[model samples]
Target: MTIFAPTTDSHEQQAPPAARRRRRRVGVMSIVMLAFVALCGYLVGGFLRFTEEVNLLAKPAAFAAADGIVVLTGGAWRIDHAIDLLKEGRGRRLLISGVNPDTSVDALARLTDTDRKWFDCCVDIDYAAQNTVGNAEIAGRWAREQGFRDLILVTSDYHMPRSLIEFDRVGNIRSVTPYAVRRDDLWRGDEMPSAPGLRVLASEYVKLVAARFLSTVGIVAKQSVSTRVADLAE
Candidate 1:
């Protein structure tokens, strides 16, 4: 008789706090998964666009004269091509932005099959730059020293976009004409890109995106670059 009142149905019972927490956690996880998927789609789209743009640079541009030429050291072909541009009078001076610290001007000229007179008269080398940012900063400084407002930027095709970003951020050279070098390792024989080519593109794409983002966000601080202008006399 004391417990005469009917008990509430189990359906009427409120969920426990722990159950609510689990439900909330599941909802959050679902949202995170959706965001992750969306991000992946976006990145894949960007990668495709990057590849297309890089491929299009294969169409050669008309050579326009600039105050100076700057080549980012990668392969012998790149250096040789830049030197050829110099010979064509496309630029008054050629600044090789990244050179081996141990490699003297004599060695570089000899190795590139360049005439020693070219190095002595019109070519300058920078031994300080270790990466793209360094290359931009070093090249900017060299351009300023040479009173050059326009520059011809030489680098591999895939590297052109990123190089442009850095050069733009550096902001001293008023004009830049890109000379994209064709790489034998990429786009083999009108076929689909090889695994290694894809890998290289992916790496470069990520870096390019990062550079664009950082530069946009105003988070790109001037890097402390120790510049070593190679003595052409050496």
Candidate 2:
């Protein structure tokens, strides 16, 4: 009787070729998919950065006259612009939300070129909000308390879209006018050039995408307030 014994060595050697082929295919597909995604991201980012709606917020006429001005903190220009509007009589009350607790009102007044009395009476520094969502929450509460029906919302041009979504959640507000700061060009002599570091543009694009997704799921619903006081406090 003749019996043949199976060898493990040949099988082990052959197995590597199959595994290597599968790995190579997967690597190529991953590279292709990554390249496609990167191209799409760049296109979307550029479009959002240059859109008319995004650029309109910086116009002074956008918030010419409103019941109140709500300045979302983060950008240095936002506070300065809000103070200018206050000085120009844009509104009776100004809410500077997302203030640092460590900083005193007097310090803020100096930074904003307004007096402490003005901050004490007309301005309310909100220390609670730490993000855009928090800015809406805190500002909504204060606006309701002050009985402001119409509001002028101030932020960077790129940030206006997401800010609008957050502010819209507060009901009974007649109009949330967006006042965006121009960031694309900082003039140095006669030429206008792209500002170094497009951080705001990039960040706002991400937030805009997230807001769109959230809106689609109905998270950005307009809430109803029986009385302005009731909704603002809640």
Candidate 3:
């Protein structure tokens, strides 16, 4: 009987490719897990910071006058508060940005139970904006054209930070006084938050982080609002 000697090379060749593949997969999975953990940490940190910032609106001081008032339409209270400010002589012009295209001035007047004269005289509605980003761009352009140096920016408390950042990106308006619309029990520590409220807060936090990233990357700075809208249309 002829016995073949086992060589080192043969033993090495006998190692299963499947084992190597398994090792490689484990390495990739470990890297992915680490990345996921990092992202979660960042999001949690951002959410905490966002909550702190929004809470500051609980005790707002009296805001001085500005050249114009820009109310981003989302909640009914935001519109009402902005209108109250306008009637109080907070600003010379009131720009109701992000109005629904189908919504007429009369409809808004009816919703707020205001006189038609308010819309006819001081209020200007922009149907161009579809979101907060659009609101900033269209409103910024209007403010620039009208030579408004100062503007009061109104939105929900959670939304104010991101909106201010977007508006500031335009660099046209000299000053923006933020007026947050209070939502009753929005952040009451005494009670557990509703699912819907938590979801909204989480979403806004993500948006705030994204806006900051885009602002830092110079992407937001380079593109004009009209250009973005035209691109979206195409």
Candidate of highest lDDT: 1
Give one digit per residue, the lDDT tens place, for model 2 in 125-188.
Answer: 7776667877787777777777888888888766788888878877767688888766645322
Best by TM-score: 1
Clashing pairs in 1: none
lDDT at position 232, candidate 3: 12
**What would the TM-scores of all predictions be?**
0.86, 0.69, 0.78
Candidate 3: RMSD over Cα atoms? 6.6
Candidate 2 lands at a TM-score of 0.69
141-175 per-residue lDDT for model 1 (tens digits): 88888899999999998899999998997678899
In each prediction, how many residue pairs overlap at the backbone (N, C-alpha, C within less than 3 A)?
0, 2, 0
Per-residue CA lDDT of model 3 for 59-80, tens digit only, reads: 4798799999999988758898
Point out the higher-scoring one by lDDT: 2 or 3. Answer: 3
Off by over 4 Å in 1: 1-13, 221-224, 227-234
> Can you give the lDDT of residue 155 in candidate 3?
92
User: Model 2, stretches more than 4 Å misplaced?
Assistant: 1-52, 62-64, 184-199, 219-234
Give Cα-based local distance difference scores for all models: 0.83, 0.71, 0.79
lDDT at 108 for candidate 3? Answer: 89
| lDDT sort, best first | 1, 3, 2
